[model samples]
Target: MNNSNKKRWFKKWWGILLIILCPYLLFLVILQSNLDKKKKIIFLALFGSFILFIFLITALEPSTEEKIAKEKKKQEQLKKLEQEKAATLEQETKINELENQKRKMNLEKEVKLKAETEKQIDNEIKQSSSEILLIVSNDDKLFRQDFKLMTNYLADNYSYDSILEAKKIAVNNINKSQYSIEKLKNIKCNLACNNLNEVKAVFIKLYILRIDMLKELIKFADASYGIENIATIPEEKIFRRKVIEYTEYQNKIISFFENIKAERETHE
Candidate 1:
């Protein structure tokens, strides 16, 4: 027969039947043969050993159900790993979003704080400017006129009041200047008005000093009244020196205030 047309022994129906009956046929033949007892026993042992070998092979080999179970377990593990990875990614995204929100809140807080600080500075500037102006205006109107009168008395001899009357007026001016000092002390100052109140205080003190000097001069004139005809008063020389000093300081204060006003306007 051609090889292509030939049937394999294991594939034929009779070959399969023969394979199934082989062990039984051998057992029957061993029993029927006129063999010695020892030989029969030996053949039976060999057949039992063959059967044991086949049983061990079938027991040790993996079944279809076990293989399927193992593959299913591997798939479950892969699915669990995928789920854990997705969960980790989601957690990272949430953390990033929270961090962004935190940064945004911090930025807004900084802006609000800056605005509040700027507003506070503006209020201080306005308050300081207004108070400083008020003080300067009051000084010019109230104290300056009295100061001029005292200076005139020191400069001229007879156009003004008598020595006794001038002395009384000088005392009055001193009291008024002292009062102005107290009033100026009450007005609080700010950062922009640094040393301003102190400057005004010094000016008032100088005013009082000049007035006191004038009083002394008037007293001297009164003491020498009718005893001798005084041509030039000695105290007038000292009083003129004080007047020059006062005028220079007054000019400095005026310039200082002008500069302050200009600076304040720039802020506006």
Candidate 2:
């Protein structure tokens, strides 16, 4: 405190003196009231002892200012604890919300990826379907027999040399056709599958018919090559069988193309 305040506090000695005497004065009043001498002495003794204890306790006890300071410190500590608890709960709530947001974002990403993959697969399927039809259309013209070219040598005559020459030319043509068929078989569908098990069912049917056409072509080419006597070798029968197989496979290809269109449209 400043010098003036310190002087004023020191001047309160009379107040201290009055507080010390107040308890004794109260005890004396109690002793003087109506009572037997023995009871009065016992009560006086107890009262004196209580007065002594009060003096000792007052001397040892903290000042009023100290009590106020301690109460303020305890209130600050309690407030700090409350603030810490609130922060912890808020932080936990934020963490839970962030985790929930992350899960939702992951779920959305997974769905988007699934949809994109399906779209890519559908595009591949449609392109593969179109390519397959185009390939089949090419084969129709590739295998169409040109009898005029084969029988061109007959204009010269029905002689052994002429017949042999025509047969040799026919064999060469058959060899070329076999090479072409091999090339055709080499064509493959490079398509992304959504469900291979389902797509495979359709492809398998197409593949079976293609295989049949390949087998017939092989047989026809071999029969033509084995022609010992053109009149009796029945090479024309082999050609006719090839034509029938080709026609059947062409029909299946057209049907398959239509089916693919229908299936895609249904999904749309």
Candidate 3:
């Protein structure tokens, strides 16, 4: 054929073939139509048949297989992209769930820790109250002992001015009177005047002295007890010094009473 005739032939027929086959091939690819072939040779032969059909009907042009391959590759790439997107979404969801669970656990732990701490504090407060009550009771007993001893000394030496002076000092020092003071005063007046009315008045005064002595002694003892308790683990030297100080104070007070008792005995 002449080149012009061939060119015309190629242009008209090839253009027609492309118009007919392109849509059909694109539809097959779009629908993902699969043709079963048992062997590689069979697959190639099927592809060659489409090429031959196009060649016979029109002048040689681009084959349908290349377009189909490109479409298939594009579809595969899209499928891969969809799979990756789905996987990423799943991972993000799992991560968010894990984070929420971690936050919940941490919150629960914090709540539990707070509750435990409050319980410990409450127990400590109760323990401290109990200790204070015990210490107060001990102070009451000591006050009673001191009041009884001083009263007995006075009763035996009522004529002595020193005995009366001691009573005046005790009354001045005491701030309030309770049961012990009333008893001590009654005993004192009975020893002094031998009158029933005076004896009754003495009882009231003793009661007042008892209450006053208890109040003052508790205040002092509480302060000393707190200081000593906080220093429970103090150095041995510091402990010894505190002990010595307490002993010296006790000895001085005892010596003063002893001198009073001795003077009374000599006069008698």
Q: Ranking by TM-score, best first?
A: 1, 2, 3
Candidate 3 residues 1-268, lDDT tens each? 5743454321466755774766444333323324443444565566668777977777655469977998899999999999999999999999999999999999999999989866654454344323332333344456456555554643553334434444553554354334334333333221223333332343343344444443433333333332433224233234335434544544554554344335434433
**Alpha carbon lDDT of each predicted model:** 0.66, 0.59, 0.49
Q: Candidate 2's residue-wise lDDT over 1-268, tens digit each?
A: 5753454321367644654666465455555456788888888889889878988999889899999999999999999999999999999999999999999999999999999877877766665555444554454344344324435543453344554565555555555545444444444444464343354444445445444544443444455454555444555466456546656765766676577657656645
- Runs of candidate 2 with Cα error greater than 4 angstroms are 1-56, 144-191, 194-254, 261-268
Residue pairs in collision within model 1: none
* lDDT tens readout by residue for model 1, 104-176: 9999999998888677666766665566566656756765776566556634664334554556666676666
Q: How far out, in Å, is residue 12 in model 2?
A: 33
TM-score of each: 0.57, 0.50, 0.36
Q: Order the candidate numbers by lDDT, best to worst.
A: 1, 2, 3
Estimate the TM-score for candidate 1: 0.57
- Worst 10 contiguous positions by lDDT, candidate 3: 187-196
> Best candidate per TM-score, number?
1
